[model samples]
Target: MRALVTGAGRGIGRAVAEHLSGRGYRVALTARNEDELHKAAAACAGETLVVPADITSAVDQVFDRVEAAWGGVDVLVANAGAGSSAPVHRITDEDWSRMLELNLTAPFRCVRRAVPGMVAAGHGRIVVIASVAAKRGDPYVAAYTASKHGVLGLVRSAAAELAGAGVTVNAVCPGYVDTPMTDTTVAEVAAKTGRDPARVRATLAAKQPVGRLVSPAEVADAVWFCVGNGAVTGQGVDVSGGAVQS
Candidate 1:
């Protein structure tokens, strides 16, 4: 099987890439950072193709390389995204647009490019690494929340349209993940509030009923299930350590 994972340079995307490759999939990794992408590729136990590029603009190139070698991608994990934390009053138009473009539009563009070949072959899986923000509203980070909601919308619509095409469109909604992104957020919160970084991190983790941040590998397991199971389409699996029950 051939799989293409965006944002594979780090975090949940990197974990997913490694897991899939271990399961015998030929993985293609894409990320903005060339060095990180190479590292991710090296970590894959199976064959890997490192196609470093800004996913929002270079999605096609990533697909093209995968297609050239393996005919078509069996799985496309659209995990490249950015998060921003700002109150509505503080958000600029550029910030909102950037959030939407990176978190929502980019995945749609990748799906648009990958769907045709999947439809032709009668098998494919598209998994988006959305956030728990997709399901509920948050105080700050309005743009990030909106964009994630838009991602879930895209998944539902695409899944409905591809009902009988053997293509599953789904999302993994993680919350307070123990990744670099969350660590950055913790630092930002600590810096803004005059609280110790450890305290801030613990507070964020406490939001989950499990009293801890979800691991990147846990989110990757959800992605792997979505890619492998044909019956699980149009669904958003919450890997949020019981933070999101619905």
Candidate 2:
């Protein structure tokens, strides 16, 4: 199988590409950072294509590059997103726009570009990397939460639209994953609360019954399950270690 994974330079995106490669799927990795993409590609088992572009701003180019490289795609993993926490009064237009573009609009564009080819082949799998914020909104990240909530709705809509064509679309929502993003947030918390980074991270982990941040590979495993197993569709499976039960 061939798969297109967005935001694949690092974090969960990188893990997803590596996991798919290990499963014998040729992976096309998309992201804005060329060096990171190359680094990630070097870690994969199967052939990996690097398509460097900002998926949030230049989705059409990304789609064209992947479609041209692979001829068509069997799977699409819209896993690139960002997190922003702006208070209700502190939220700026740019903050809202960038968060929405990165988290929601970009994924939508990837799906839109992939479905037609999938329909032609009569089989396709789509796995969107949503977040626990989609289900449980917290303070200071209203816009980010709203964007992920949209991702769930998009998955539901496409599940119905693509089911008849033998295509399945699903989402994986993870909470407080242990990645660079989480590291940055933990550091920020440390700075704000005047505690050690480890303490701040531990406090966040306490919020989850799992007693730790989810691993990138764990989140990728959930995405792989949804895409590799065709029986599941339109489902938002939580991989947050029971942090946000739905």
Each candidate's number of clashing pairs is 0, 0
Model 2: per-residue lDDT, tens digit, 140-164? 9999999999999999999998888
- The local lDDT score (0 to 100) that residue 209 gets in candidate 1 is 94
State every prediction's TM-score relative to the real structure: 0.98, 0.97
- Model 2: pairs clashing at backbone N, Cα or C within 3 Å: none
Q: Which regions in candidate 2 have their CA more than 4 angstroms from the true location?
A: none
Pairs clashing within candidate 1: none
Residue 187 error, candidate 2, Å: 2.0
lDDT, candidate 1, 52-119, per-residue tens: 89987888888888888888898999999989998899999999999999999999999999999999
What is the Å distance of residue 31 in model 1 from its true position?
Answer: 0.4
Per-candidate RMSD, Å: 0.8, 1.0
Worst 10 residues of 1 by lDDT: 56-65
TM-score of 2: 0.97
Winning candidate number (lDDT): 1
CA-lDDT, candidates in order: 0.93, 0.91
